[model samples]
Target: MSVDVITNTSPVIWLGRVLSGLAIAFLLLDAVMKLVPIQPVIDTMQALGFNSTTTLARGLGILLLGCTVLYAIPKTALVGALLLTGYLGGAIAIQLRAGNPLFSHILFGGYIGIFLWAGLLMRNNQARALLFP
Candidate 1:
């Protein structure tokens, strides 16, 4: 296969496969978060001026987890990739805002590099027509 096909497609599929466990774990955390009394988390959210930051966080986590699950389906690879990419973007942005260098690099820089590089190869000629043409 050409680099395009591999990068744009395979990596997304691979990520879905690899993150299956992580997705599940995040979902579990989301559920547990809903059930348990999370005073500290709520307090942090309140302090941050994000009225429902905890719920939003849990919702985003679940959304990404669902996207990961959808990614496992071959036909949905592109959609899954978009979702995961967006999720990582948000994660990167949030980490940066918090001045967390370690996680910022790990979550944003590293994942962005890998995902973007891989996605490049997956784009079809039609998708590339505007730029590459």
Candidate 2:
């Protein structure tokens, strides 16, 4: 794309970066619950229906988050885009299941859109290099 087009997509770029952080924070929350093996953290995730599989959840969550963070960093942004985009997919699925048409749908949908845009932007040679490396 042209410089003008890329310049106008600043919001998308920012959203992608923020989403990377969010992914990290959320997964870290899960990771703390599982990897740390602390009762309190496990209790919390269990309360939220993340019981039994907390370890797997934690590992995947962290792996996904790490991917996004790496993507935000130079030379690894595309992988981050891949990770964040897929993570958002799972997020959208879970949020959709909650069945709150207003809050759940809008919030998750917006998040998905942002990540998708970021992923697409990251696909571009210019945007990818700028954001990732």
Candidate 3:
């Protein structure tokens, strides 16, 4: 494995970096909102058929934050991606059950997940090789 491969500073990698930062910021904000359990968060959870208890919300927040943190780390991004995939799957399911819009709501997680993986693939040689080669 050449250092050049891993140390790429191409436009694609830069784009990936930007996308990853955006995704991480989005996930972090979501986790914080869950932990905070503001009225909108509680209402959304309730609408999603979930218990609006602070305990549950906080626990989910911790889990999401942990996964997002892992994803943000270059060394653990793969594991974090896998964990977040499952989390996004759950979100998709909830939105589906709630009869939300197909593209905007039901497939929103998939959209984010694509960006997450795309960023990883572009920014990480190991990820690109594993996924593409």
As for TM-score, the candidate ahead, 1 or 3, is: 3
- Sorted on lDDT, best first, the list reads 3, 2, 1
Candidate 1 clashes between residue pairs 3 or more apart in a chain or in different chains: 4-121, 7-118, 7-122, 8-121, 8-122
TM-score of each candidate?
0.49, 0.53, 0.91
Q: Which candidate is the best by lDDT?
A: 3
Native-to-model Cα distance after best TM-score fit, residue 100 in candidate 3, in Å? 1.1
Clashes of each: 5, 3, 0
Candidate 2 similarity to native, TM-score: 0.53
Mind giving the per-residue lDDT tens digits that candidate 2 earns over 1-110? 66445644667556655655665565456545556566675664454456446565567656754764676565666566666667667656655555546565637646
Sort every candidate by TM-score, greatest first: 3, 2, 1
Q: CA shift at 87, candidate 1, in angstroms? A: 1.0
lDDT of each: 0.52, 0.57, 0.89
Q: Which ten residues in a row have the lowest lDDT in candidate 1?
A: 121-130
Off by over 4 Å in 1: 1-54, 102-109, 112-133
Per-residue lDDT of candidate 3, residues 63-112 (tens digit): 99999999999999999999999999999999999999999999999988
